[model samples]
Target: MRALIRFLFLLAVVAALVLAGAYYFAGRAAGPQIEIHRPTRLLGRTGTLDVSIQAPGGRFNDVTVALTQQGRTVPILQLLNPDAGGAPPDPRTKLTQETGDRIRVTHPLDRQTLPGLREGAAVITVTAGRPVLFGLRTTASSADRRVEVRLTPPKVSILSTHHYINHGGSEMVVYRVDPPGAESGVRVGQLQYPGYPATGAGVQADPTVKVAFFALLYDQDLNTPIELFARDEAGNQSRASFDYRVFPKAFRKSRIDVDTRFMERVIPEIADHTPELSVSTASADELLKAYLVVNGDLRRKNAAFIREQARTTVPEILWAGAFAQLGNSQVESGFADYRTYYFDGREIDRQVHLGFDLAVTANVPIVAANAGRVVFADYLGIYGNSVIIDHGMGVQSLYGHLSSIGVKPQQNVANGREIGKSGMTGLAGGDHLHFTMLVDGQMVSPVEWWDPHWIEDRVLRKLREARSRPS
Candidate 1:
């Protein structure tokens, strides 16, 4: 009986040892991990692949990457048999060794790199192999990503001609874009003015036709090239140029003398309205300092805020005929007036006043310049009680320095409708209405837009011709 018991105990110990050995081998057989960082969905004409690989023992035997489409596979990268001193098979594949167990690989996936590539569904596969069990066995891991290859650019064409834009003024263009829903716009140097469907402008001619309102600000050069561009979701872009003329004008420069009472009135009010600015309106010196901050920093912030608000404009023409100016008001300041500010016999700062300052009777009722929706009706930094109306197609009008606002945001109003009452609010010296025309968030001269003949010739003529012509 004792001999038989010893035999059974030995058999049990052998079985435990075999189980431990199998577990150890199975753990060692696990492969390396892979991570792909870019081109998560669509691969364009010039796309890149970023991949990372990690191995358990700080070393990988081989790594290979290939793209498969329509049942065909094309190798893009290969790091083969590093222990055998084998280099990468493709010269364009960039390989980096982060550590013994980790590596990074990047390669271009463009058509020039992969000549066999076509616009269709594709799969990117990355496989990594690491040696285990004393180099006798190879453990492997793979990662695959599905993406669409897009090679064709969107088609853009100009449908209107005889475009004339005044320096520091606004203009409109009508164009057509294939793939109707693609993002199409007018690109002027570094600035982009978005396009709206022509149907939005009440034109029932073509669904693909688009209209855009653009501007040449007081700062941009007259010769700055402007072109219409169409870009698809896959980052493919196409641009076309149309004939346009630019007329330059001389801007007037003036000096603004700052006084103690003006600072005392304006600084404290702006500071009270704007909690974002940290300033003590107690002393004259501090008031002057705060005034500078409001003029320079707060002014820039307000401009940026207006630009952001412009993004919410409806993609249609809400205004008909020319925009209107304040009734019986005299222009106290013209658009783009280069003003040099002075305090205590010394120049403090210089800034360009982009809007017209019109003055009538104190606390006079302010009216909307055109038919549109009110985007903002509140106390805006320097503008005080202000109202911004979206005239659509990226064109808007501003009625600033109001004592009271009568309209609410998103409320539609007709031309010459009362929006507020003018007062000495914001940075104003006296009761006035600061009026301007905004083209795609850019402040432009409202003179042209206020003229009946200019509106008919520059804007309405193009829309009429586009609707009358065959698509």
Candidate 2:
């Protein structure tokens, strides 16, 4: 009887050990994990749903993903495989996968896929299986998340009808958009001119409506399409087109001769500032290269910085009439001039001069061209000592290569107020001011801004007309 009892006890202990081992392997097995990337918060009516699927050790035998909103379950994708999708065997499906580690899922989500999905939270559940019972069975789902869906787009309309856009100048547009919090702007090519809350002048800026001053640089294609765009938090987008009157004009072209003195002064300055020039000991060829770098590479970077500074502007009309020009000054160079540099009688480089070069007495007073809040008053590369004044509604003026600056950032200056003095500090052949007018950071013709007639007929007339209309 005792021997039989010992035999029974040993058999029971062995059975328990087998069960413990099976449980241990099952514990290591993990369910599918989902990382939702897109529709981050509010899903758009017509947008994409991006997610990443991951399995720790083995592949999933079965995978299922579904979206549940208002008691409705919409299936996204399902795959039945023994190997938790270590390597993807199929294309067309975006499942970022590395053999045996993780997988991803990125699919389009819109009204077509998720019927009746409205502006609210929706639950996303993912279930994945990994063989744990000696490669015999799989585990259950381990991921569940929520996504916000927004299917409605913001309403937008143009208030200013008459828009005068010089082929390479700036203009202002006043428009209204519903849902005061929605983002609205004008899109030209890849660049977007943002909308700001209008303020200043006698006119009150409405929260839903704003006036944006934007630019048309000479570099941009004259025929490039433009549109006014608005979008809400839900990624719903709307667009509107306005009647635009384009004025075309020819730009000046000139060949500038490079002198020895000019090269020596500019090249050393370039090498001192730009580490990429790679000319510890300046040679003729290296000096030319440095000059090109400063003209081409550095020029573009400085322009981008200026654009960033001009992005934030007041909404109200600041200036009263035409912008002021420097007194007793002569036009040394014209705006939108196509310039070619000749070195040793050979054409070395070419660039488009975006600003008018005004020759004035050395260290003469540099005044504000119009009444505006000083947005940027600092040293800018290539332009040297520069000051940018924001004339509200995305309209701004750039005064470059100044000898001295008398104003600080955020300070308000009236038209003809002395802000600085002219100088030959940056890439300038002589003491002069590089004056340019910009709309949304795009260079435009300054001639129109200087003419009171143009302001009344092209810009202010439309604003007056818009305000006179019934609410």
Candidate 3:
């Protein structure tokens, strides 16, 4: 009996050692690990889910993703069998993959498809299981996410009238927004021009009312809808159209002849300063091609750079009344002139002259069109020695081809202040000043801003009404 008892004790000790070795190698105590990556808060009606799993020393046997609401289980996806489990229709958005013992899946959620998203509180559960080496399969789950979705859009309305805008001119609109947090703006084409808090200068200072100066680009389609748009954080959008009249004007066209002397002088001057063209050492033919490329390709890049500077502006009104032009200067060219360039009796290129060219001899004083801060004062590609002034609220003026700049960037200059001197620095045939009026960086006819009568009837009259109205 003593020998038998000793033999049983030895057998029990051997069994305990084998079990400990198997568990240590397989990591059965930890079980499968699951990690869920989700946003801390969901302000929008739609969101997404990105899940990652780490199964050590085991292969994933079952994986399920589901949305639970009102005791209803809507299965989002399952990865049971590679052949039996079909993927979402769009693999880029919803996908499941496994590499070794790890698995990952990403899915996008929309309120329209996922009805549970409309519920006030919905739970998203992810459960995963793995098969271990010792038949110690374990399951892990995470149901910690309870989402809140909003779907109501904000309201916007126009308060002021006489919304007449010329084809290549600027106009101001006064509007009101219900929720101050919503982003309200003017939507024209793909671009949205945001509105600002109204000032007591033009429109009465109201917390809800917003003032926005918008432009109708010369090349914009007449049938395009220009409406006030508002959107909330929940992805809800709203639009309201105001009564307005657009007067379309036919722009003047001109043909410019590019001769040997014109090419010889402009090319050498440009090539000497601009090495980006790589045409300083080229022949006459190559120089002409380079000029065409500069006029076409480089022109767009210069305009884009100028437009990007309009993003930051003072909210207050910096200037009032009609803008002042360069005194004793004659208008040499008009705005929006469709020009055709001819070289050696053949048409080489075509471009639109956006601003007016004022001639006042060589190196004449150029004054600030209105009171504003200088945004940019440097050499540009086509408009060399350029200076741009911001007159607040998306209204700005640009002076190009200057002989010398007098003001630095961010310097405040009043109306009629000398900012620079004009010269034939850029792509020009003679000494002239390129003056342009930009509304939100879109080139508009400066003739409107130069006429005092137009300002009183269209712009100042609207301001007078706003001032007289009970605040």
* Candidate 1 local distance difference test against the native: 0.89
Worst 10 residues of 2 by lDDT: 84-93
Segments in model 2 whose C-alpha atoms lie over 4 Å from true places = 1-16, 19-21, 24-33, 53-63, 79-93, 97-104, 116-121, 128-134, 198-206, 273-281
Q: Better model by TM-score, 1 or 2?
A: 2
Best first by lDDT, ranked: 1, 2, 3
lDDT of 1 by residue, 31-91 (tens): 9899998679988777888998988645778888889999999987778864454666777
lDDT for position 15 in model 2: 94
lDDT of 1 at 420: 87
| Candidate 3: tens digits of C-alpha lDDT, residues 76-148 | 6666622234554445445455655565667766664466555355677777776655456444444456656
In model 3, how many backbone clashes occur?
A: 0
* Tens digits of per-residue lDDT for model 2, 216-294: 6677788777788899987889989888876777888999998767978866765565555455335777777777877
Q: Each prediction's TM-score against the native?
A: 0.85, 0.87, 0.81
Ranking by TM-score: 2, 1, 3
